[model samples]
Target chain A: MASGIAFGVVYLVYQPFNAWITEVFKGPALPVTIVTFIFCIVVSLLTPPSTHTEEERVALVMAERNQEKTASVR
Target chain B: MVSGQYAVLFVIGFFVYIGLMILIAYMTSKKGTTQGEDYLMGGRNVGLLLLICTAAATAVGTGTSVGATANGFRDGWLGAVYPLANAIGLVTVAFCFSHVRKHKFRTLCEELQFYYDGSPYMRKFMSVVIFIVSIVWVGSAINGGANYLAYLIGMDMIPAKIITVLAFGVYVFVGGYMAVVWTDAIQAVLLFGGFVTIAILAIPAAGGFDNIRAAYEAAGNPGAMTAFGVGSKGVLGVLAVALASYYGAMAGPTAHMRVYTAKSPQTARKAILIAAAVVGCFSILPAIVGMSGFTIASNTGAESVLANPDFTFAYMATTVFPPAIGLVCLIAGLSAIMSSADSDAIAGVTTFLTDVYALIFKKPVEDKDIPKYSRIILVIMLVGAFGMTIFANDIMSYINNVIGSFTPGMAVALLVGRFWKRTT
Candidate 1:
């Protein structure tokens, strides 16, 4: 959330690039929309997925096994 | 061309919208049994598409089209930048989603009460304050509906206001959150269709790039072409607008609550990210509309553009489009107004009845009771909101003031609760 808030604060300083791009395209409908759409697709891909990994799963199983083995000894 | 036809069409459109809402309410609801969670949060099964659609629809409302456009017309692109600020706030909410959802809390007020258990009294006080703030916010939304109906139908504002409040209140009271969400989904589509169509047509209406450039020069605001405008005043002024927009976004309770109501942290994150992208696009509509008005009215003596910036979108639609398209746009505006109002009202009432009442009364409230009492509370609050709207001045300004006063404190506290070491 702070990252998003910070983004807003920083955008004020960096928005010249957005304006420049808009002006560069000179208001053509297709290019701007297509470019923005593709950028969004890339960003979506870049966003970190929340699922866990196989190594982490193995570590958790090993920890469980160790706990059970200790419990049996106790 | 006649006044009666507009009124008749509006009435027909209103009923059609209500019928669709009723159908949604009856269809989506689980068979003969719904708990508080089901009614308020849609059983937490909201998929990525539904969540994104609802968020985008809720954010892109009549206020954005009307007030944002007016602000854009008066102040240039800076005003339109507020939606971007809101997108940033939503992204922030997305980051906090996992923490809040994993805890399994039902509402933000509940989260507040839990976090502030150090002072139970403070929790109650803040809960009441949150309730009042939401009421005030929803009240202004109700007024937006009335204001639009009055303008579109050429009726007195009071009658339109009453009709709007009553219409939304009935649909919401009967249907519950299922109704509100699905209705919002439909309304969002309408709003998107109207605005996108207008924007596409407006590219030409703006006379393409050359005409826009010529218009900017004619308006004697070269900075309007560049990123830095004369209004920057200093670093503080530049930051102030950005901060204000960001603050406004954070202050919005409706979007904040959606994070909790979503089915999963992943779904919520995806929704927020999608909303950011879609709302970013929708944000440009008002700028386009306002600029189109600025361009077309340059020679047409249409001072309404300047006199009431709030009416710029409507003015552009009615003046530029065919009668059918214009009416569709009007209905679209009404969709924006009612969707926001109804959803906010449902959320406000649910918070009050379930969160506030349960906390104060010291009872384990059953899920079965929430839908009924929530509807009752919704009516009572809508009545109170209606009274306020009739007497309130400048709905947008009032909303901004409400956000400015309350949002900073809430944001600071919530941020601390989520990220600070002490809480964890």
Candidate 2:
């Protein structure tokens, strides 16, 4: 979700910014790279850390499998 | 049109590349076990480098290379928005869904099934959707490659497409996902190198960057020099295309398989980041080449490639570089198509076997039978894709319409299912 929002923000800004840079500054790459870097940083900051650890994920998978097996038996 | 000598070089180069891909497939097939998991997902142990290359290659296919360059020829910088958006979307996938790599799901539908409390309905629906999408994707890839082959070698479109499809199908049928990955890695290099070489050679041939801009201005299309260009579809259109391209990269079955096949979540995440950077850089090259082609045509009083922008890359390939380098560019364009075709073929077959056939019939194939069944399914899917190509007259528009219509719904479903606690 954060990534999606970040992409939206970047898309909204980048188009006009890219045009301005290309027309006035005659440089597209510098502005694009800068905007991309900023967008990535913002997205990384906004995205919450992973909720489940590796062990928790494995345990969850196992539990789901066991539940499926029980349901099938029923 | 390409000269006879260059056509010969292109054919030789193409066949040699195909032979190497087949050899790689054969070698990989011999070393691996023939289990369904191994064939379909590379045993879910793909490393970072291979993942990066395969994902990048799959995303940066004929659409981004030849198609985008052609658009650039007509629309200028606006033509690059699709790939630029794709690169951003890839990074978004890494940031948002890298943890999916930890799961052992074989197809996107399997993930959907798990999210929907094991309900098979969503799986069935998504399976059919992805299957059709993958087949269409394969056809588009063939269509793009055939255009290059037809233009470069003067072969008719159908025969060129047949040969292109067959070349990729043989390798995928023989080696499965592993072959696809290894070949994608090689093709990624060829694609990147080919485009970069053309862009470099084209600058001088078009009489430098300044001259190209001057010519574009002189042609009474000064807006083409701007970032938005004359073709900058309104803000909503831009956003829609961006989102569609993003969804295509993130939620599409081929890309979903890439996530599933990664060795680990961290590996997938890292690979996505690297691939995003590579794709972002590679996306601009086609635009550069296309813009150069436009400039060349304007300056030389040659026939405009604008009448069919899809031929812009091919026009430049034949006209801008030496015969040897031009041959490499043709092969690179072919590689772009093959890389996508092979990946989509594997994804389509995997979806059919696991999500559609297995779930609908409740009949799982034995491990010993996987390789044979996979080959059979791959062939059927390729043939089906080929048949569809006959009806798909405009490759880019067809792809865009399908993706634009379907992806937003898929993206919403994926986001809701993944993060919304009440989705089920």
Candidate 3:
């Protein structure tokens, strides 16, 4: 969010920063997305894991089993 | 007198094709369950054939017809990289996420909700993002279609834009998902056949590959004949263009909509794989056609083709082919544009109703009213996109770079959210 606003909104539009950004990153869109994905990981690591992790695992198992059952029934 | 006669024939063929599509939409509505799951996801019983056709048809749209042709005109074979990258996305979906059909997900938003441990924030955010992407995509498709029409028919832009919208909108309005799939199935054959035919004819018409090469060499663009766009666009430029298209394909909502509608996970996987194979096989056809257009324009100084290279396919089809073949090929190009436009338009309408409309209205729409509201929103969405298309002279710049600016954020989020456990 910050990088999107900073680069896509603010930095890329301004002259010196935009020129500097071009010198470094070439185009900001793809690089900023990579940055955003890293932020997802880094921010998540810095925060607590969701409590529903185990339930989510079971939900996948259930989905597989339900699919199998549906296949068999059909 | 000869060209005028063909022009009249082209007009008649165009109306007949559009009328046929609308008729197919009406027929499908009369027979099928146009309510609830059926309306949205084609009753969740789409088989391999329907899925393959719809998936391929949607993937091969505006980009292949207009934008990639423009890219090919400018960058040579770098345009082939796009369909190839899109094929990779389709293959990845087949292997990695086809099982999502088993979950019976309707929107990518719902898929996000499932992936993010029922988190509402990502879903809500994705709704807004997908909605915007949908509108932008439809706008781009309309832009391409309208330009192609205006150039070929010699009509003013606004009326051409309206016809472009109605070409797909009326059917999608009446018949919903099945209408899109069935019409797309028929169009898939035409688009593929037409593209391949034009490419084959265009090479000889441009005085053969050797002549094209000589023309480019003489014109000082020997690089446009190269394999990877390495000579024309630097390695970094190629990589950047390829990357922008790739992730967008992996997370494209219309493709996911196909997955959701497939009869089973296995069926979805197979359909997507086949579509990938089909798209991969046809990747280079646009390059041939576009390069042919470039050759013709460069040699003859066709003012219109030179002025707007986005109309490369149009110029090639209408001017290069015989009258009857040209009409068929032009309809095929229209098929490519309409296939994607209608699917994206439907995807946008679905996102709006499920996410934004529900959030504001305090209740899910009654199943019966889905079609009604979908029609209303569909009009509003197309009109909004029509406004965007009129000001844009170049389809590739607005549709490609403009869409490139916004879509990657949500695409990356979806990839991470599903693949990584720490999304929350």
Candidate 4:
């Protein structure tokens, strides 16, 4: 959700300051298309991983199974 | 008159498209589990060739070709910029495809939901928006086919509207993703063949490339000679902007969905790269055709510029080329139109089924329910599209506007999700 909020702010900022961005940036001026394109690339780079690490996922499953075994033994 | 020749081409192309559609449905129907996932997403096993052809066919629709032709007509070679933007987007997707498909998520909303799971409500919200946008996309697609039939047969649009809706409903309803992908592959080849043929015939008729080049100079549309010729006031500047815009929006729903459909991430990426090259390479044909229109108009002093840009390509083919070649051009135009609409209709319905029904309902909508619901939504969307076709006199305007508005936000979403590892 922080990412969404961050993007919302960025959207507003980009809209107002879009004309100045291309000039401020190194390459072509921030024509709407270029700015939006760069924005997508930058945000995609920021997105978090969707899945758990293999070690972590396996560890959690193993732990739960062991607890079940212990309970059965008792 | 070229009318008789165009009729022959239409009959031939129509039957050819129909035959290929049936063949694909038969071949892939055996792939097992015609569920929501398999039917809509090609069972997540799409290979490089099918992915490339489907992406290119869907993205480079009649809107792209016809609009570019019109742009070429009004502004010289300046129209090619749109396809260039589209190509850039395709290449960007090629690079991003592997990472996106890594998650094994069925829908793009799932990708978003993965990252923003903290706000469960937000995930639901975004999914709804995405689903609606996908549905809206069906409008332009059906309109494209309806418009094409009107141009080719000189028939009233009522019959054409029925044809567009029913054809989309029937084939897409039965075949699903496998059908959309394989048929699009065949259609893309025909589209390329048709466009290239018209362009080759037009060059000589316009007194060869040299004469065509001379006509641009004569009209004082000199920028048409340059790579940046597609935009008038901001040529090179617009090209750069368009390239960046293309990169951001390259993997919009249709292309992004294909990423998930691919056999593997590598397959997805390779397909996108190939599609990028294909779109860039084939884009020149319509520009050539547009220039031919300008040349013919210059010599004949005809005012053929109508309310839509698609007419520029159609007019040039039927008017300038010999009857046979002209027929080929119509076939190509129809191929591009139908290929795009069919794939889009399938994708749109898939999104509706997966994103809205499956997700929001928060229950497993049995495997058998998928094809049934998909066909139902497809029929509904096509009916809606028929309405849009009737109202949309300037279909190109809506085409450009819709892309301009929807894609940038989605691009931002994709960027943050892919690079930041936000989902972790």
i-RMSD of model 4 (Å, 1 decimal) = 9.5
For residues A1-74, write the lDDT of model 3, one tens digit per residue: 33333445444347786677566655555676877777777877897776565445336333332222212221
TM for every model, in the order presented, reads: 0.78, 0.83, 0.90, 0.80
Q: What ranges in model 1 sit over 4 Å off?
A: A1-74, B1-11, B29-36, B114-122, B228-238, B391-402
Model 3 C-alpha lDDT per residue in residues B51-81, reported as the tens digit of each score: 9999999989887567787878777787787
Which one is best on TM-score?
Answer: 3
Residue-level lDDT tens digits of model 2 in B314-385: 888787777878777877888888898898899998888776676566566666777788899889988877
Deviating ranges (above 4 Å) for candidate 4: A1-74, B30-36, B117-119, B240-249, B306-308, B358-360, B391-403, B422-424
Candidate with the larger DockQ of 1 and 4:
4
Docking class of 1: incorrect
* Best-to-worst ranking by TM-score: 3, 2, 4, 1
Per-residue lDDT for B122-224 in model 4, tens only? 4456667666555556666566667777776776777877776666566676778888888788878878888888878777777876776777788787767
Clashes of each: 1, 0, 1, 24
Q: What is the C-alpha lDDT of each candidate?
A: 0.62, 0.74, 0.78, 0.65
lDDT for model 1 comes to 0.62
- How many clashes does the backbone of model 2 have? 0
- Where does candidate 3 chain B have its weakest 10-residue lDDT segment? B393-402
Candidate 4 displacement at residue A30 in angstroms: 5.8
Model 2: CAPRI class: incorrect
TM-score of chain A of each: 0.29, 0.38, 0.50, 0.27
| Of 1 and 4, the candidate ranking higher by TM-score | 4
lDDT of 1 at B73: 64
